[model samples]
Target: MSQLVIQDLHVSIGDKPVVKSVSLTIKQGEVHAVMGPNGTGKSTLAKAIAGHPDYTITQGDVLLDGRSLLAMEPDERARAGLFLAFQYPSEIPGVSIANFIRAALQARLGESAELDATGYYKKLYEKMDLLKIDRKFTSRSVNDGFSGGEKKRCEILQLAMLDPKFALMDETDSGLDIDALRVVADGVNKLRTGQLGILLITHYQRLLNYIVPDFVHVMHEGHIVRSGDKSLALELEAKGYAWLKKELVHA
Candidate 1:
């Protein structure tokens, strides 16, 4: 099994410190939820690990399968099996979903290696069916004028097609209604059975209710403060971040 180790990571954006000394390890086939209120640096952690240019890793390291990710470019990090599902997926006009995903898969292959077109379509249809997406969706432009639900489901479709070793999903539930959230969560749940460790980031427990995590971590003021099982998420939903703040003060 592969592992993604984030060792005492400290991130800064334009010299403003965001994530501080955060450490965690995600092994394949596990879902770890990192939950906290907005502006707590949850997204920063994911962006930093994904090699986003705006965020700098001032301290520590992120390793994929025991290799440091700090030196790799965002695209290189992606090819190395680190997938970062964005909170807001970008809209690409004139690119069909089928072509876009096919291009990504093609990039992963060596120059001399040819992608088997028939096999690719076969697998794509299988995954789309598993997610309950309409086969006709293949012809739509990527997230161009899509509803919130459609955009998120498209992100999941990309995830399924890419099949990375580990994924960092930042606020995937943002702007989603109950029905859309359920559909997106269902897509994620279906993909959890392989070498696909996921670090699911969200601010609310409602998302967790649909997609139960093996571990739940709480981030506060740029660092991880608490971690436990799915029950911790329920506690957070009940008492809220203010209560956790007070408890931290007492502790």
Candidate 2:
């Protein structure tokens, strides 16, 4: 089974440490929510794991199915089945969404192998239909001039097409209206299965109401201070982070 194991991870931006010895394990088919206030290093952890150069891993190891990912480059890590859905997806002007995803998939193929264009479009259309994205969207530039909801939905579309074993989704619901949030949630829900593991990072419990994670982790000051099932999310939602801060101080 595929699993993502982060052990004693310490990450930094330049010389300033952001993640302090945070560790977690996510198994295939599980949805693990990482909740924390801004600057608590939730996004930092996800970016570090995805091999973002800005966040340096000062100490620790990230492993995927027993293989150490710390040594791999960002592209290498991606090809190894690790995917990060950004909080702010970049705008790639002049590049069609279909071409962008096609390039990514092509990069993963063997040198002598070729992607069947007809087959590729067939699969892309199926995934687009499933996500409720218009078939005409394939020709649009990636995230260019897209609405906040449309951008988020575009990321989900990429996720669906890539079929990564493990996905780190960072604040996917940000800037989305209720309708857009539901659409994105539906796309994510449809992709959930025993073969994929997802680490969902968000601040709001409202998203949890839709995605329904298997586990919830509360992070504070770069460490996971609390963990529980879905109820924990509700508790945190009602009580807010103040109680969690107090508990951490008392502990």
lDDT of 2 by residue, 1-251 (tens): 88999999999999999999998999999999999899999999999999998989999999999999998999999999988999999999999999999999999996788988999999999999999899899899999999999898889999999999999999999999899999999999999967889999998999998999999999999999888999999999999999899987788
Would you give me the overall lDDT of model 2?
0.94
C-alpha lDDT values of all predictions: 0.95, 0.94
TM-scores across all candidates? 0.98, 0.99
CA lDDT for candidate 1: 0.95
| TM-score, cand. 1 | 0.98
Candidate no. 2 TM-score? 0.99
Residue 19 shift from truth in candidate 2, angstroms:
0.3
Error of 2 at 106 (Å): 0.4
Q: 179-221 in candidate 1: lDDT tens per residue?
A: 9999999999999896699999999999998889999999999
